[model samples]
Target chain A: MSSTPLPPAAELARANEELRHQLEEAHDLIHAIRTGAVDALAVQGTEGPRIFTLQGADQGYRTLIEQMNEGALLLSDDGTVLYCNACLAGLLQCDLSEVMGRAFADFVPPAFRDYWAGLLLKGWESKSKGELPLQTRGGALVPFSVSMNVLSFNETATLAVIVTDLSAQREITAIRAQVEEQNALLDRKNEELKREETARLAGERAAAEASRLLEGISQIAWTVDPSGANTYRNRRWYDYIGVAPGEGPSIGRAWRERLHPDDAPATLARWNESLRTGAPFEVECRIRNADGDYRWMLGRAQPSRNAQGEVLQWIGTYTDIHEHKLALERIDQGQRELLNYNEQLTRVNVDLDNFIYTASHDLKAPISNIEGLLDALLTELPAETVAREPVQPILHLMQDSVNRFKRTIELLTDVSKLQKEHGLPTEPVDLAAVVRDVRLDLEPLLQSTGAQLEVDVAAAPAVMFSEKNLRSVVFNLLSNALKYRAPGRQPQVHLRARPEGAGVVLEVQDNGLGLDAASEQKLFGMFQRFHDHVEGSGIGLYMVKKMVENAGGRISVSTNLGIGTTFSVLFNR
Target chain B: MPLQKLTCVLLVDDDQTTNYLNQLLINRLEITDKLLIALNGQEALDLVQAHCHEATPDCPALILLDVKMPVMDGFQFLEAYDKLPLPEKAAIIIVMLTTSLHPQDVDRVRRLNIGGFLNKPLTKEKLNDVLKNHFNRHLPE
Candidate 1:
C-alpha cells in the first residue's frame, strides 16, 4: 500500500519485480483452476495492470471454479440454490443453465426433499456448515458441503452462502460401496457357474457308472435291429462259443450263421416265428465255433418294444447245451435198438419152435401114401404066403422100410432125450477095442461096397463112456460109411481117436459120395440123411451123434463133395 | 334113332372080372351087337369115340365110366370126355360107375348129366334098379 514515486531506473526495476510477483500468483491460481475444468488464467492489458472484482456474477462459473478447486455448492435462504458448477451439474446429468436460479427444494429427490429443506433451514439459522447429498438427473446422489453465513447487502439481509462441490471428494467414500456391489454380482455369477459345472460333472459320473455296470453283465447279451441284423453283444456270448468277439457280425452276418447245417433250418424257423409274432424265442442248435468244433447251444431272445408297441430290437442270450441234446438222442437210439433186437429174438424163437411142426406136416403126405400101399398089399397076401416067393421081395422091401421107420423114430426119441439129459457116461471104456469090433462087424458090407476100413484106435488112449454105446457108435459110423459108398470110387475109411486136452477126440473119415455143404450141416439132425437113394434109415448116424453128445462130447462134420467126408466127435477135457 | 342103328355102349375098367361080367350083362340087353372092346380107360375112350364119329354114327347110347383104372384112370377119361360135344345129347348115354365113395368124387360126378350111375359088379337085380330111375327119364322126353 505505497504511493507512487520513484527514480526512473529504480521505479522500473521495483515495478517489474511487483508485476512478476503478481503474475506468479495469478499463474498459480489459473494452474489450480484449469487442473480440473475451470480456466482461471487472466491476461493483463498492455496499458496498465488492472484490478477487477464481480459480486454474484456468473455463479455457475464461480461455483465451477470452486468445484474445480475441489469445493462444494452453496445454497441461499428461501430454499433457492445460489450456485452450481460444471462438475456438479454434469455429474447430475443436468444443464448448468437449468441449475441456476432453481429452487433447491425442487431439485431435491422426492424422498429426501423435505429432509433437505429442514436441514438447510437449521443450517442457516445456526450458521453451520453441513454435508448433504444432492440428486442428479441420472438418479445418482452427488455429495456436497455448504457453509451458511448471514450477510447484510443492499437494503435487506440474506445468507452469505459458500458452496463446495464434493463429487470427487466423496468418490473416495463410495469406492468401498462400488467394490462391495461388484463383489456381490461376481459371487452370484460364480455360484451359478459352479452349479452348472456340478450338474455336468454329475452327468459324466452317471454315464461312467452306467458303462461300468453294462460291462459287469455276463450274459451274451446281443441286440438285433428289426431288420435281423446284429448290433451289439456282451462278452460271454463270444467267450462261450469260443470265437473272437464280434467276428460273426463283422462277416456281414448274424451269430446264427455259426449254426450247424442240421440245426440251421429249425433255428431259422423259430426265429422267423418269433419275429412275426413278437413273442419270446428259444432254440437249441449246434454251432461251429472258431476252434472248428461243433458244440450245441441254446439261444433265447425277446423283442424290445418302443412306446408305440413296435419292435425295435431283439435282445438275446446264448448257452451251451450240446451235452444234453446229444445224450437224449443217444438214449433214444439205444431204446430203438433194444426194441429191434428183442423183436428179432422173438421171431427166432418162434421159428425154432415151429420148425418140427412144419416139417412133419409137409412129410406126412408121402409117409401116409406108403402106409396105404402097405395096408393094401397086406390085405391081398394070404396068411401062409406072407413069407413066400414073389411076395417075399415086396415083404423084404416093406419090412425094410418099416424097420427104417422104426429106427428113425427111435433116433428122434434119442435126440429129444439127449436135449433133456446131460448126464455123462462116467464108466471108463476101451475105445480101441470097440472100434475094432465095429470094423469086423461091417467087414461083409464093406467088402461088397469095395470099402476099406483103416482103424487108428491107439491114438486117443482110453476114454470114459459106456462101452456098449461106444460099440454102437463105431458100428453105426462104419455101416453108414459103406452105405454112402460112391459110384466110381471104392470107399476108404479111417476111424481114429486122439488124446485132446483132458479127453479124447474120435474122428471117422470116409472116401465116398461125400456130403454136400448143406447136407453136412444137417448130418447130426434127428433123422437127417445124405443120398435119399441109399438104403437103411437115416437115423443110424443120427443116433450115433446123439450118443456122443449125451456123453459130454461135441460133434462136427467136414466134407468135400465128390471126395471124402469126416465126422469128428470131441469129448470135453 | 332106328332099331337096326341102335347105339352101342362100352364100359372099361381095370377089374377084368368086373369087365367080363359087365360084358355078359350088356350082351343080354342087346343094345348093339357090334361091341367095342378095350381094357384101359384111355383105349376104351378112344375106341368108343372113334366109332362114334363114323358116318353111320354108332355113338354109344351109354358108356359106363369107372372112377379108377390102370394106365389112365376113369377120372382122366372124364376129363378127356369133357372136351367132346355130343351131336345129339339125348342119343349119348354115359354113366359113371365105381366102388370109390369119396365125397369129392361124388360131388364131381353129380355135375355130369350121364345116362345113369351103376354100382360095381352089375348084376340083373342092380341093373333093374338103375333101369327104373334112368330108363324112365330117357323115354321120348
Candidate 2:
C-alpha cells in the first residue's frame, strides 16, 4: 500500500474534477442495484472467492478493474470469453457484448492459436505470460504481451488474463537495434579512414626521402615531362649550376642558352631526336655555369614509360668530365712535342755524318802528296851524293807523319760509314772461314811478331753480320792482338763464338799487354788507345764499337793489367 | 822499267803542285815524250780540242783525270765527254786519279769508261800496271 504524494495545485484541480465524475458514475451504479438492475458482485481474490452485495465497497474492485489501463478479462475452460473489462473491449475496438461470449482464442491471430493453447495449459500455476498477436476489429494484427492465471469463479474453473499492447516496446527495441548497427558501421568507416591517412603520410615520407637522396648525390639530377618541358631539378642541380630556384624553363632552351656554342647545335639535335623517339639520350658537351666558365659535362637520360609504352617522363644526369678531357689533351700535346724533337735530332745526326765525310775525304789528298814527295826526294838524293844526309831523318819523320795522317783519314771514313744506317744486308758468315782469312791476311805481321794464333770456331759455327763490316772488325781485333802482345810472351790469341742468352757472343781473348781499369773506361772512345808504343790510329776499337752498335749489338772488354784482355761482342738476334 | 815510252801524256788536276809532281814523276820514269797539263775538266777539254784541231795532232796516249775540281768535276766531265765525237775521244787511255778511294767514289769510277782508278799520290808501280793493262807495254824493272 504505497500512497502517491499530492501533486501541485495545477494537477490537484484536475484530479478533484475527475473524482466528482467518478462519484456520479458510482451513484448511478448503486441506483441501478437498488432497482434490481445489477444483481451480484463476484471477485477472485488472493484468498479465493468472495461474493458481495452490489451496494457494498467490494464493488469498488469491479470499478477498478473496469478503469484499469491494461485490458483485463476472464475466460472459461472451454476458451469462451466469460467476462471482460471495459478496457478489454476498448483495446479490441469492439462492444463489451461482442467480446463477452466470443472464444478467447478468436482474438488471437490464427498463427498464435496454438501458443494461446499452450499458455492456457500452463495457466494452472500462479500466472503465466506469453507474447502473441491479437486480431483487432479491423482485421489487423496487434502485438501484445499476455499474462494468464487459472482461477475459480462461482465454484467453476476460469482463466484470468491481462494483456499489454507491445507495439511501442517493439518500436523502441527496433530503434535500439538500428542505433547499434549504425555505431558498428561508423566505427568500421572511422577505422578505414584512419588507415588511409596513415598510408598517405607514409607515401609522402618516402617521396621526401627519395628526393633527399637524389639531392645528396654529387651529379646533377633533373626530370622532364613527356612534352620535353623541364618539370623538376634536384638540389644539387641548383648548387652545381649556381642558379636560383625556378629560373630555368624548358630544359632544352636552358641548355641551348648555357651550352658552349660549339656544342649547342649537336647536343640539341641529339636531345630532340631522343625526345621524338622516346629513346635514351647521351652526349658530352660543355655547359656554362653562372660564373661564365664552361666545363665539359656528360649528360644522359632515359624515358619512363607507362604500360602502354607512352613516355611519361625523362630522368637525366649531368656529370663533370672537364678534368679528364683536359688530361687527354695534355697527353696529345706532349706526344706531338716529342715527335718534333725526334725529327730535329735525326737531322742533326745526318749533318754530323756529312761533315765527317767531307773533312776526311779532303785530308787524304794532301797526305798522299806529302808521302809522294818524300819518296821522290829519297830516290833522287842517293846516299853517295848526300855524303852526310841530315835531311834524310827529317824526311823519314815527315813520311811517318803522312802515314799516320793517312791512317787517321781512313779511320774517319770508316767511322762515318758505320754511323750511316744504310740498311747493309747481313748474311750468316762462317766464323771459322773469317778467322782463317784474317789469319792469312795478317801472315806477314804474324811472322814478324812470331805470334801463335789458336782458332776454335767450333762452339758457334756462324754469325749474322755484314761481310765487309765483319772482315774489318776481325782484322782490327786480330792485328791489335798481334801488335800489343806481351814483351816476353808470344801472342796466344783465341777467337771463339757462342750463344749467350738471346744473342751470339764473340770473344777475342789475347795474351797481350792488358789494359788497366782507367784505360778500359776510355778504351772504346774515338782516338783512344791503351798502348801508345804500338803503331795505331787509335780508331780501330771505336769503329768496331760503332759497327756493332749500328747492327744493334754491344761490345764489352774484360782485362787484368799486364795479364790479358778479352773483347766480347754480343750480336743480338 | 815495266812501262814503254808513250807519245805524250795529259794531266788534268785542280792543284798545280799535284800536276807538277805527277809530271816530274812521269819525266823521271821517262815514259812519255811530252806532258800536257790542265787545271780542270774545262781546261782539259780545251787541250783535247786544240790537239785534235792541229794539222799534225799530238794526241795524248794517256789521260790522268783528277776528281773534285772547280768548273767541272770528274763525273761531270765523263758525262760531257760521252757526247764527244768518237774520233776525238776514242783510243785514249783514261785513268781516274783521286785522293778519295771512298767506296762511293770508287763505285762512281767503276761505272765510268776508264782504264783504272788510281789512288794519289799514284806510285810508279801503280802507273806501270795501268800502262801494261791499257797500252800493252810493261815497265822495265
Candidate 3:
C-alpha cells in the first residue's frame, strides 16, 4: 500500500511566499495607520458614527485598535493591565476598567495557567514569544500562541504582540492519537489473552523440540520411515502390544509382522501410499493389548519432507478409541429400535382412528332410536302434562344423553371424514354460481328475517374443487355469516375470493356477534358451538377445515369481540 | 286408476332400529305384504338377484337403504346394484335414507342414480312422497 508522495519543499515554499506577501500587506497597512499618517475613512464616511480626532496619529491608532481581530492586551511591568482593546475586553466578558489592572493568572484555566505564568515571565526575563493558555468568559480552557516583542515606541517597554487561538487543532490531534494508542494496547492484551486461553483450553501450545515433548504423553508417539519399518517405537505401544520395548528384535519389521492377520493387508497398503505421497495418514485399527483383548486404536501421522518432497520421517501417534467405537454401535442399535417404535406408533394411531369411527358409526342408530322413541312418547303424552312429571324429566335426561351420543357420533364422523378426504378431483368451479346457489338456498331465512343478504361475486375468483363440496362450503359459510350477523347492525355478510400466493384467498367477513377469545381456540372443533342462539351442529367449521385440508389448503379466523368476525381461507394451487 | 301394493319390500341397514321402524311404517301403510330384511348392501344385492327371475311375480317391488352402514353402505349398494340382475316383476325402487347432515350425501345420491335421500326416522309422509313423486304408482288413466 504505497501512498502518493507530497509536493517538493520548493512548491510548498512558493505557496508560503504567497501567503506571507498577503500577510505583510495587511500587517504594514495596520502599522502605518496606527502611526496616524492618514485620516480614518470610517469616521468621515456618511453612515458611520461621528468621531472627532484631535491628533491624526491618535485617530490612526484608534482605527488600528478597532480593526485588529486578535484580543490585544498590554500589561505594566508591575503586572497591572496598561491597556485593553474592545476585542480583549469582549474576550474577558468584563468592562475595560475592570480588566485594565487585574492579575492575568485569574482568568486562565487551571490546567494551562502555569504555561501562561511561565510565558508572562519570559517577556521580562528572556525570550518574549511563547505558547500560553487562557480561559474564555464561558469558562472553557483555550490555547493561544503568542508572539511578543519588547518595544521602544513610546520610549518605554511597550509590547508589540500577535496571538492566535490553537485550542481546536491541538485537542483534535491529541484525542485522536490517545484513542488510537488505547485501542492498540487493548488489542495487544486481547491477543495475548487469546493465546494463553488457547494454550490452557486446547493444549495447542506447540513445542520446538518434538522428540523430547512426545515422551510424556498418554498417546503412543513414534517415528516410521518410508520403507514399511518402524524407525522408533514408544514404550506405551510396546506395553499395550504385549511386547518389551528392546526385547523385540530391534524396532524393525517385527511390529508389522505382529499386526493382526485381518488388519495387516489394509494397514500395509495405507502406510505405503502415505509414504509414497507424503500425505498425512489416519486410520482406526484393532490391536492386541496385554490383556489379550483387542482394542480400537486411532493412528495419525505427519510426514516431514525435504525440498524434493522426499520423506525425511513420519511422526505417528495412536490413541485408543474403543469406547467411542462402542458408543457408535449403541447409537446404530437405538436408531433401529426407534424406527421400529415409530412404525408401531403409526399402526396404533390408525387402529385408534378406525376404532373411533367404527364405534361412533355403530352407536348412531340406537341413539337415533332413543331420540325418535322419546319424541314419539312425548307426542303420545300431552306436552303441558309432561312439563313437571318425573318420567318426563327422566325422558329429557335420556334425550340429553341421546344428544351427547349424537355429538360424539358427529365427531367420529368428522374424524372419519378427515381420514377419507383424499384424492379429490379438482377443476375450476365458478364461485359466483356457487354463491348464487347458496343465496337461493338461504332465501327462506333471508325473506323471513328480512336480513339484507348481498352477494358480490363479480370480484371473486373461481377456485378449483369438487363443485358439490365447494358449493356446500360456500353455502354453509354464507348461511353461518347471515345467522351470526351482529344483532342490530343490519346483518352484512361479505364473501369475497381473490387470487393470493399460490392459491385463492376467500374471505367471509360478517358484522356478527363475534366469538370471545376463549371460544376462538375451539372455533373449528367438532361439536364446539360458540353461539347457541343460532342453529349449528358446531361441525360446520370442522367440516370446512377437513375440506380445505383435504384440498391442501388452510383457513383462519380473526375477530373483534363485539364488532365482527372474518373467516379467511386460503386454498393451495 | 288402481293402487297396486308392493308384494315384498327389501329393508337394508346395519341398524336394527331403522329396519324395525321402516318395517313398522311400511306395514302400517299396507304398502307391502311381505318385508324382507338384509343386514348389508351385499345381502340386499344377493337377495334381489336371487328373486329377479320370479315366475309368479312374488318379488320385492321396493328397496329402502340406510346410507351409513358397515360392510356395505348405500353408495356401495348403488355401485353393486348396477351389476345385480333383477326382473320386471321385481319393480325394485331403490330409495336412500340417511342421517348424514352433509349435503354431499344428498347430492351424491341423486348423481349416483340412487333413488333419493331423506332425513332419518323414516316417516309415512316421506314414504308417501317417495311413492307419489318417485314411483308415481297411481298413474292417471
Candidate 4:
C-alpha cells in the first residue's frame, strides 16, 4: 500500500473525474424512480430508513392511460417491463404485478424475440416501433406493437417504451382478405352464365328458321306425334278442308264427317295400320270439298324417324286426284260401249248367214220337185208332140235353165256355210298335199284352159288350218286361174308357200284376163265376176276368201288388166 | 230281168207336183198291182192304216218317204209306221227321199231304222238300190 505522489495538476484532474462519475450514478437512480422501473425508493436519515412509492404519483395521467382502448405498457432500456396497464395485463392474460419488473424479451414469443432486440437497439439511438407476438400466462399468443424511445429522465438516459396489443387489428385484416377472394370467384361464375345464355339463344334461332320453312310449302302438309295426335297443319290444309286453323275436327271425326261414306271405313283402317306399324301410308278416297261435292283425293303420310328408327312424327299430304279419276271412268265407259257395238255387229252377221242358209235350203226342195215333175211330164208326152222341132228346143232350154238354177242354189248353200265353219277345229295341214288334191279336182278345167301350173310348197309345208277349207281355198284359186284365161293365150298359174314372220304365206299367181284396179278392189267379194264366159256362179272366189280369213288368216289380191293376177293368203300358226 | 212285182207301193210327199211325179214314175215302173199316192206324211199314214189293217197281200210292201212337209215329215211317218198294228210291218220296205243332203239331215237319216236314203228326183238307179238293199228285189231295166 504505498502510493506514488503526483504533481498538483494530475491530482486535480483525478478529483474532477471522480466527482463526474458520482453525478451520473445519481441521475440513473432518479430515472429508475420516475419511469417506475423501481416501484419504491429507500432513503437513509439520521434516525431510520424511509420508503417512498413512485406508482400513482400522477393520478390523472394514470387514469388516462388506464381508460384508453389500446394496451399501455412501459419497458426499461434493458428490455425489462417496468410498468403495465390493466389492458396490457389483459392482452398477456396476466396480472399487472406479474408483468412489472419482468423482462419484455421474456413476454415476447420465441418467434418474435429477435425482432424485439432489434427494436430495443434502435430505441437507444432515438425512437423505434415494431410488432411482435407476446406469450401470455395461459400459453396463448397475443399480437402487440411496441414503440421505444431513448429519453433523459432526472438527468439520466432511459428507454421509454409504449406497448400496444394488436390482436383485434390483425383479425380485421384477415376478414378483408377473405372478402376480396370471394369477389374474384363471383366474377368467374358470372362469365360462365353469359356463355351458356348465348348458346341457348342460337339454338332457339335455328328452331324458328325451320318453322318458317315448313309454313311456306305448297302442299297441304301437316304433322302429328307418333300417337297420331295432330300437332301442326299448314294453311293449305285448313283451306282445303274448309276449316279454320285450330278448328279442324279430330282425325276419327273427320273420317265420318268429311270423307265420303264409301271411302271412310277403308281410309280409317289404313291410317290406323300406318300409325301402329310406323309405315308409310298411301290411299285413294273421296273427300267432301268446300262446295260439298265429293272429289277423289290421294292421301299420303310418312313417319319421321330418329337414328334408332323410332317414330318421332308423321308428315302427311292430300292431293286432288278427281280429274284423273273421272278421265279413267270415261275411258272405261267408252270401252264398254265399243264392246257392245262389236257384239251387235257379230249377231247381225250371224242372222244374215242363217237367212241365206234357210233360203238356199228351201229352194232345193222346190227345184228338185220341179225337176221330177218335168221328167214326169216328158215321160207322159206323146211321141209326135215330143219329137216336134220347136218343142225339142223349148225342152232343152228348160232343162238348161233348171240345171243353172240348181248350181246357183248349191253355191248359195256353200256361201252360207262359211260363217258356221269359222270356229271349226284346225290341225296341221300339209300345204303340198292339199294343193295336189285341189289340182286333181281341177284337172279337167286345167286341160280345157291349157293352163300351166307350177307348185312350190317345200319352203313352208304345213299350216294350222282346217283340211277341207284349205283344199277348197286351193281348188277355187286353181279353177279361177283356168276359168279366166286370156283370149288366144295359155293360162299360166303358180302356187307358192313360204314362211313370213310368225306365219305362212300361200300365194296363187295367174297369167290370165286380169282385172282393172276398180274390179280388183272387189275381186274376192260375193257375186263379183270380171269374166262372164266362164261357168261360174260368181261365188267361188268369195268362198275361197272367206275360208282363208276365217282361221286367223288374211287374203290379198293383186292384179293388172291383161297382165296377171295374184292371190296371197297369210295363215298365222 | 224284171223284178218280182210288189203287192202295193206308197208315195209320200208334200208338193202336189212331186206327188204326181212320183205316182207317174211308180205307174210307169208297173212294179206293183196297187199304187198309193199321198200329198203328205199324214195322208200316207192314213192310207197305210186303212189298207193294211192286217197281214194281207193288199198291205203296202214298199213306201217312199219325203221330208219337209207341213203336218208330218218322212221321219214322223216312219215313227207312226213303226207303231202300226199291221202284222206285215216288219216285212215292208221303207226309204227316205229328200232334196237336202245337209249333214244334220244325213246324220239323222243314218241313225233311223229305215231301209235306205235317196236323193230326189228319185231316179231308177236310186230306187233299184233301195229295192235291192231292203226288199231283196230289183227294179225293171
Candidate 5:
C-alpha cells in the first residue's frame, strides 16, 4: 500500500485504490463482529461470554436477555450448553459456570429427557416449541414452556431457545374446573328444595279440604272411641245439638239426659249391645231439640276398623225424622176418625130403616081397616036410605075423604119403600118406555088438562137406573106438569133424552105455570110447593132429586114465571 | 044375603068392639047358626077345644084368626090347632083376617094352610065368599 498522488482522474483513481484497501479491512472486522464467529473475544470484567458484540447495541441486547422473566439459552448442534442468561441459570437453580458446557438433557427431568432429545433431533433446520419439566441439581422439579430455534454460521449449527415457567397457567385452569363443578351441585340442590316445597303445600291443601268437607255435610256427624267416649264432633253436630264448641267428652254422656223418657231405656240397651259386639249401631229415638221439645231422630253409627279388625272408632250421624213421624201419626188419627164416622152412619141407617118399617105397618093397617069399615057401612045401609039426596051426597063426601086419606097413605108408603130399596141393583132401563107408562097412568089427568106430550128419546133411549125409581120419577113429573097447567094456554110437555159426554141427559120441559125465584129456591125441598092452588104433597120433586142423586146422577130445574119450566137430569152411563 | 050351611062361626080378636061387630055381622048374614067369641088366640083355642070335646053335632064349623094379638098370636094358634086330632079339625074352615095389607103378612098367611085371607072389618060379601068357596054353599036371599 503507498501514499502517492496521481493525475486528477488517474491520480484520484490510484489514491481511491489505496483508500479502498483500508475500507476493505474495516468491513471485514465489522462483518466478523456481527456474525459472532469470533472466538476467545471477551468483554472484560463482565458476565458476557466469548461472543462478538454490536458495540453498544450488543450491550443493550445482553441486558435485555439477562433481565427478561423468561429464561434464555444458546446451544451447540449437539445440544450442549454454549451460553445461558442469568434467568436461565436461575430457572435451573444453578450457577452460570455449572450450566456452561452441560448437555441440555441434564437440566431436563428424566420424564422429559426423550422430549428434549426429540427437539435436538430436528437439528438447526426448524424451531421446536413444547411444555417440559426441568429438574434442578437439588432433585426438585420445575415446569417450563420452551421454544428452540437452529441457526447455521459458516456451515456450523447452533440453537437459540426461550424457556418459560408454566406453574401459574396450570393453577388458573384447575380453578376454573372446580368453579364449574360447584355450580352444577348448586343446581341439583335447588331442584330438590323446590320439589320439597311443592309436596308440603299439597299436604296442607289436603288437610284444608278435609276440614271444609266436614263442615259442609248436612247431618250431625260425630266420632267416638271404642269405649263410647267422644273424640271429635263436626260443626253441624255442635249447631244441631245446641252445644258450645270445645265441649269435653262428657257431652256425649249428657246426650242421654236429652233423650225421650219413653225411649231412653231401650235405646241405652241397644247401644250397650252394639258396643259389646262392635256391630253397626242404629236406633230411631226421640231427641230433645234446642227448644227442649222431643223430636224423632234416626241415628246410625258404623265402626271404623283397623287392619287387625279391631274397632278404632265409631262414626255416626243423626237425621231428623220429626216431620215424617208426625205425618204418620196424623194419618193414624184420620183413619180412626173415619172409622168412627162410618160406624155412626151405619147405626143411623139401621135406625131409620126400622122407623120406616114400623111406621108404614102401623099407619097402613088403620087405613085399610077404615076402608073396610066404609065398604061395610055402604053395603049395610038400606037401598032407599042410600039413594036419598042429602044422605047420598053426605056419603059421597065421606067416601071422597076416605079416598084422599088412602092416597096420602099410599104416597107415604112409596117414600118408605124408596128409602128401603135405596141399594137396589140397577139395570139398563128404557127411559122412553118409562115415560109412556107414566103418561098412560096419568091419562085421565092429561085429558082433563088437555096436555100434549112430546117425547124425543131417539138420541139416547136407554139409561142405567132402577126401573121402579125411573117409573116413579117419570110419573111424578108428568102428573105435576099436568096439574100446574096455566089457565089459558094448553099444557105442553116435552121429554127428551140425549147423549152428553159420557152420560145421558133426560130433560122434561113444560109450558105450564112456571116458578118464581123464591119458589125455585125452595124447589127440591120436601113439603115445598110453588103453587098453593095445586094439590101437591111437595114430596114428588124431593123424591125425584133423592133418587137421581142416590144413583150418582144430577138434576137441575130452570123455570121462568108464566113462561115454561124445564127439568134436566144427567144420568151417568 | 045369608050363609045357610055353616052351623057355627068363631071370632078371635083382642079388641072387644071388633069381636062384637063381627058377631053382629055374622048374625045379620045368617052365615052361622051359632057364634063363638074369644079375646085372643089362647082364648079361642080353649073355646074350640071345649066345643070339639063336647062332641056337639055341629062342632065350630069355621074359625077366624087374627094376627098380632097380646098373648098368643095367630101363627101360634095355628101351630096349636095342628096338634088337635084330625077328627076335631075335620069339616072345619079356618080363615085369616088382618088389618095389615103388608106383603110380609100376606106371604106369611099364604104359607099357612088356611081357607082364605081377608081384610079386617070383614063384611058380609067376604063372609059369603068364604062360605061359598070353602063350604060349597050359596047365600040365601
Candidate 6:
C-alpha cells in the first residue's frame, strides 16, 4: 500500500535473490498441501496470523494407515523416506523413528538395489509394483511385494509405497509346495500297491484252478508228500472209499484198516521200499470195499521230482482187478481137472490092451492044441475008413471046421498085436510100392475072379505110416475087391493115391457084389460077413480098418448095391 | 544027418492038450529018449528040481516052456532056475514055446538064458531049428 524508492544495482541484486527464495518456499508449501503430506498449515487471519490442522478430520484414516498389516511409507522424489507406518517399521524389525527420514533404498538388499531404483523411477511416472528381498535389522532377507504410487499435490510429488511382509506368505508358499510333493509320492506308492495286489490275486486263482482239475478225474487218484503223508485226494477217491469229503483216513490207517489182512503186510512193505528208494511203486492186493467184500486192486504210484532230482511227492491210482484174477484162478482149476481125466483115460486104455493081448494069446493056444489033436487023429485013422463015403465027407467037414477055428484064433492074436503097435515109430512109406506088393499077394484071387486091377499112384506117392501097417491095409483092400466080385461081370478094380489136405488119400474102387446099406454098416465088424456066397472069415475088413486107424489114417467105404464099391483111406502124415 | 538023441526033454504048458501036443512033437522028432509033461510052470519047476539037482544024463537036457500059468509063469521059472545050485545049469538048453508072439513075451524070453523061441503048435521043423542052433544036433527029415 505505500510507495518505495528504487535501490542501487548491487543492493537490488541481493534483494531480487531474497525474493526468489521466498517465492520457492511458497510453491513447496502449496505442493505439500495438495499431496496431503502436511496435516496442518499456518495462515494469516484478520486479527493475526493463525495455525490450522486437519488432524480431527482425518483421524480415522490416519489410524487405519498406522495399524494396517501392510507396511506403508511416504518417500521423497530423491528416494528418501519422509514418513513410515508402525507396520513398516515392524516389518523391517526396527523402530519407527529409525525408519523415518532415511533413504528407502537403504532397506533394500544390495542384490536388489537396481530393481529398487527402477521401481522408484517407474513410480514417479505411474503406479509401479515389484517383488524383491529386503534386508531386516537382523540382517535376514525377507521376500516382499512392493507397490508404489506417485502422489502429487499441485506438482509437489511424493511416493506412497505398500510393502507386504512376505515372510508369512513365503512360509505359506513353501508349506503348500511341500504338501504337493508329498501328495505325488503318495500317488506313486498307491499305484505300486495296486499292481502287487493284482499279481497276488492271479496266483491265488491259478492255485484254485489246479485243485478243481484234480477233483474231476475218474480213477481213485491221490497224492502224498515225500514223507508219505497224504496231501490230496480226488473226488473219485472219496467216492470209491465210501467216505465223505475231507473225512478220509490217513495213509497209515488206510493200510491197516481197509486192506485185507493177508495183503496189508505185502502192500506196506512195497510202499515203504518205494518211499525209501524214491522209486515208482506198484502192487496187486486185496482191499475191503464199501460193501465189506474183499476185492483185488492194482495200485500204482509214480514219484514226482524237482529240478534237483529229489522226490517231491507221489501220484497214485488204484484200479479194480478182482474179476480178472478170479477168472484166471478158475481156468487153472479147470486145466488141472482136464489133465487128471486124460491120465485116467490113458490108464484104462493100457489095461484094456493088456487084457485083449492076454485073452487072444490064451485062446490061440487052446485052438491050436485042438488042431494038433485032430491032425494026430487023422494021421492014426486007417486009409479004408477015410475012403468010406459018409465017413470021408464027415472027416472033410471036421477038417474044415478045425481050419476055420485056427484061423479065427490067429486073427484075434493079430488084432491084439495091432493094439500094441499103436505107438510104433513111423516112416514115409511109398504108397505105390505097398500097392504093388498087395497086388502080387492078391494075384491068384484077382485071376480067379477075372478082376481088372488098375493102379495109379502118381498124384500122391508116399505117406507117413508104419510099413507093416501100410502093407496090411493095401493087401486087405485089394483082396476084398477081388474076392467080392459080381457073379455076372468080371470085377474091375482101381487103386489110386492122391493128395488131400496135409495128407494122402488112397482110393480102391471095385465093381463087385457091393453090399446093401444094412450089410455095409456091419461090414467092418469083427467076424461079420456080408455075402454068404463068398468064403470069408469076415475079419479081413475089420483088420484093415484097425491097421489104418492105428497108423493115424481113416477108412471109409462107399458102395452101390450090386454095382460097385469104393474104399477111400485118408492117411495123415 | 540025424541028431544024437537028448537025454531028456521037458514040455510045459497051462493046458494039458498043449503039453500033450508038444510031447508028441518031441517024441516024433526022436530028439530025446526021455520025455516029461507038466501042466504049468510050477510043475515043470518041480520036475526040474527033482531031476536036475546035479549035472548028469538024468538031468533034463532040453525044456520047452510055456509063458502063462496059474501058480508060476515061464519067466518066474527061469528066474528060479538061474538061482539053482545045480552044476552046469547053463548047459541045459531052454526053448520058449508060446501061442502068442507077443513082443513082451518074446523080449522076456530072449533076455533069459534061453536058446531059442518057437510059436505054438510045435512042429518038427521048429524043433529041429532049436536043436541045431542050441545042441548042435537036428532031427532027421
Q: Specify the highest-DockQ model's number.
A: 6
Error of 1 at A222 (Å): 3.2
> Model 5, A5: alpha-carbon shift in Å?
99
Worst lDDT run of 10 residues, candidate 3 chain A, spans A36-45
Maximum-TM-score candidate: 4
Residue A153 displacement (Å), model 1: 46
Q: Which stretches of candidate 4 lie over 4 Å from their true place?
A: A1-237, A248-253, A259-284, A298-319, A432-458, A488-494, B1-12, B31-63, B71-89
Report the lDDT tens digits of candidate 4 across residue range A1-573: 239666588776898788888777567657765775544423223466443334334756656776776676555555566556777777788887777667767877787778778888888888999887888898888778878777554443557667776767788788878887888778877777776576446534433443466578776666777898776677776677677765644662243367889899989999999999988999999978667888888889888765567776787877788999999999999999999999998898888888888888888878887777777778779978888999988888889999999988888887887777888899999998898888888888788777889999999957999998888888888787777878888788999999999899999898888899998878878888767777677888888778877898899989989988898999988
lDDT of 6 by residue, B1-141 (tens): 667888888887778777777777677767788888877778888888888877666678888887777798888888888777886777788888776667766677777767777877788778778877888876666
Question: Which residues of candidate 2, in runs, are more than 4 Å off?
Answer: A1-241, A244-290, A294-338, A379-387, A428-463, A467-501, A505-514, A558-568, B1-8, B30-34, B46-61, B85-87, B91-93, B114-116, B133-141
Deviation in Å, model 4, residue B96 alpha carbon = 2.9
lDDT by residue (tens digit), candidate 4, B70-133: 7888888888878877866677788888775667878999999977778788777777777777
Report per-prediction Cα RMSD to one decimal. 23.0, 17.4, 34.8, 16.4, 21.1, 17.1
Candidate 3 residue runs with Cα over 4 Å from true position: A1-218, A221-232, A246-288, A293-316, A322-356, A374-408, A411-573, B1-7, B41-46, B54-56, B66-141
Pick the winner on lDDT between candidates 2 and 6.
2
Local distance difference test values of all predictions, in order: 0.66, 0.80, 0.72, 0.78, 0.77, 0.79
Tens digit per residue, CA lDDT, model 2, A36-96 = 4443344445697553333434666767876888898877667777677777788889997
Worst 10 residues of 4 chain A by lDDT: A37-46
Candidate that scores best on lDDT: 2
**Per-residue C-alpha lDDT of model 2 across residues B1-141, encoded as one tens digit per residue:** 344588888999988878878988888888887899888898888777777544233778788999989998777877877776656455678898887665777777888877778878777888889877888887777
Candidate with better TM-score, 2 vs 4: 4
The number of clashing residue pairs in each candidate reads 10, 8, 2, 1, 2, 2
Instruction: List model 5 lDDT by residue over A1-573, tens digit each.
Output: 257654689878988998999788557666764664321122222464444332334656766876899888777766777667777888788987788778888877777788788876663668788888889878888788888888544444568789898877788778878877888888888888887687556544543544466567898777767898866567876666677786656554355777999999999899889989999989999988666788898989888765567776777777888899899899999999999999999888767766765676566656655665666788789999999999999889988987887777666666666676676788999887887788788888878888889888888857889998889888877777788888899999998889998889988899988999888988998668777887788889988998988788999999999988898999887
TM-score of each: 0.29, 0.56, 0.42, 0.61, 0.55, 0.59
DockQ for all models: 0.02, 0.40, 0.21, 0.40, 0.16, 0.53
